[model samples]
Target: MTSRDTLAPVFRDVRAVVFDTDGVITDSARVHAAAWKTAFDAHLRAHPPRDPRLRRPFDVRDDYLRHVDGKSRLDGAAAFLRARGLDTPEETVRAVAADKERLFTERLRAHGVDAYPGTVRLVRTLRRAGIPRAAASASRHAGELLARAGVLDLFDVLVDGGEAARLGLPGKPRPDLFLEAARRLGVPAPRAAVVEDALAGVEAGRRGGFALVIGVDRTGVPDTRQRLLRHGADIVVCDLGELVVRGEPK
Candidate 1:
């Protein structure tokens, strides 16, 4: 390893790497955003009396990036609804979110989600390095996405929306999911690495006290990478391919 590699906390006590799905592994954020838009738009049309006051459907790309990209299903719904002046109860919103998930899954089955070779290569590198790996996501579709991406068996642990709700794990900015990931990997919180693309997720990593938090700037937009750092990421890169996880940087 080079000096830069030696300087990385992931090179020290890191026997594991925990990754976030959606923006991190696959290019399915667009797919999810589209599904969310469809569900929300239809729900609004069907229930005009609900608190939502929007004239048009939520924008899948921009709206999702702002409110729902890496958040839990119900949390995402609550956010968008609130944006439209709705204050539906958390539990009630959760039910709506579940319905939205059903729709999103249908879309996934039809179109399929694809993973980045760079991300798969990174996970493979960690596995070859004898380091455990896990996948964390606030989306309930994490399993389907990973399986469709053909990297389901790469992870020894999965802490996602379904599992989080089932286990009462806290969502982003609370760190429960990331913490559980480290525990499942048999790595102490301070010895594991976290890779995410959401501000909430980066905050989760910092709150969990992970060794390092690497943020992905997938949009290639200005200040997007910097926003991740401001949210508490230790390092931010445009892609996973930019970092050397198991060996010297190419």
Candidate 2:
């Protein structure tokens, strides 16, 4: 049984939680980063940087965190290209994004994703406690990935890329996606919590006025926990398992 000593403090008033799909719940964030590296590196090699100073390969950690993580494919591609001083045409952006999509899909198919045991434990605890929960992401493949992980049924609501497009909601760092998920859960933003690993996602939760924003730092990167806090997370945890409460619910 899980110990209650490390239970997440936000659950005291947080009636619902909206979790980001990637690093927070599943172990697929690294895969996505790898795919991004492959696509971006190929593009960079084909169109070498005009400035030698900027003639560097795509950095999976720094570059992904800065421009790709938690963003739409096209947005990521455009941001990365601009960072490399190569803000090409819309067609070029679309092509790059398409290549990334293909690469990610192939990787996902070859090696399916797995839900983090810590996350699964916390989610089951939330379910047993009757706390409403939702899963939200900017990626169109969010739903597919969740389904493949076999944890799709754990969420009461899902506001993935499809729903965002249907509602024309803006992406993260803008609170629209999280706000929408909270609305669907019939809970006010201040009554819900957001669990995210992306800096943009934490900022979005803060902007949305959520009760608490928990940042999951799976990467164990230096200063990452502090970065998440600086970005807007009320508290940072290394794993969702830290939030699991054993024994009976109060």
Candidate 3:
């Protein structure tokens, strides 16, 4: 375990924390990646790329991390399509995004997801310590996902994709969502910490000037850890349980 004093010194000054929902809190990122693969694969089959190098199918790991993860459905679709050198008209993007949404919803309804035990423990610890917590996600289904995982009540606030759109907040890699979550928690951005599993999310936390940007690397890949650090994560851990608050129960 990484003691707060050693690994998370900023926690002493952190007034609140904002977490990214999909991969950080709940195990739903893989579901989203699978859905994206199905949608993108179908689209690719119908419209193969002329370039041989770009003709390969979407890689759930690399493709999702680079182009789709932590982005809104439409934004993710457009980004992946562009990366594959496919035409990215608004209509095409929407069509692919819609297909992903349908597929994701079906999978979610069929097999509900669970919250990460470590994350739940961390959230509970923070709550017991009187620190406010917020869950922020690019997915509009964030709330539903949390509710299904039985961890929605753990957060004091949630800034989801629906709320972001309603407030005209831009997606990840922008500080809007994390900033809003901090704002709702009644804490200044510089006094709050942001926990995320996505590169874009860590970048947003850094751009927001949050006190700490903790990256959750569930993949356990050395390259992923380095990438997270390069993306502005102050520290990276494989699981939330590794983070131990000073004078707090293990």
Candidate 4:
């Protein structure tokens, strides 16, 4: 059994901490938002606003925050179009999503994903202290991103969308993917910690009853933190590296 005494602060019996990939570890949320906007705008522009262009195609800030983020590509595509009251064909939406993914992928091949230095430092601290760690992401490309970041070897377990779908694991806002990672890492739900930035991911952590749910408010906004708390994060931090103490051990 895990000992509460050792992991009782912001974390519980959590021997291994699980994190979301895109926003938590990497600085890719903005990239994703830009890609989504480019894809959705072209599609919506052609259709035009129902009310004489009263509204622009899509507001990346509000629209990304509301419908597309942290969701599966296909789901996101369908959702954005639905909100615009312009029902696009399934094939059309899928193609749009694929194009968006390609945009992201092209950017990746050119510049590649990079993990936050703070995240890297914190991971090292945890590893040095003998606390196992894992990662989970809604992206099927999570593995590829991690590889490009040169940190794929760090996590003991990884659960990405590709594996989740194959295993019949539910997506975010449901605890399945997080719980599945916990299972693979040999940790019980009550003894694990989950770290995420996405609203859906935080909600999933809440549903799973993880020992601790740490929300990363990278956007540095009160509303963002509030949203994370609404989904039930135990603690929210603007920076993950701040969690590391120079000479402390978990």
Name the best candidate (by lDDT). Answer: 3
Give the residue spans of candidate 4 off by over 4 A: 1-8, 51-54, 248-250
- Which regions of candidate 2 deviate over 4 angstroms? 1-7, 247-250
lDDT comparison, 2 vs 3, better candidate: 3
Candidate 2 on 1-250: residue-level lDDT in tens? 5434334556888889999999988888999999989999899899988988777988878788878888888888999999999857999999999998899999999999999999998988888778999999998888899999999999999999988999999987899999999999999999999999988899999999999999988776798789899999988989898887555533
lDDT of 4 by residue, 37-139 (tens): 8888777666775866434766655677667767778878887787777767988889889989998887878888789987887887677668888889878
The better-scoring model by lDDT among 1 and 3 is 3
TM-score of each: 0.84, 0.94, 0.94, 0.89
**What lDDT tens digits, residue by residue, belong to model 3 across residues 27-71?**
999999999999999999999988889989999888988898888
Candidate 3 ranges beyond 4 A from true positions? 1-10, 245-250
| Residues 64-102, model 1: lDDT tens digits | 767776788877888887777666797768777878778
Quantify all predictions' global Cα lDDT against the true fold: 0.80, 0.89, 0.91, 0.80
lDDT, model 3, position 229? 96
Report the lDDT of model 1 for residue 33: 76
TM-score between candidate 4 and the true structure: 0.89
Q: How many pairs of residues collide in model 3?
A: 0
RMSD vs true structure, all candidates: 4.0, 2.2, 3.0, 4.3
Off by over 4 Å in 1: 1-13, 43-57, 90-92, 245-250
> Candidate 4's C-alpha lDDT?
0.80
| Count of clashing residue pairs in every prediction | 0, 0, 0, 0
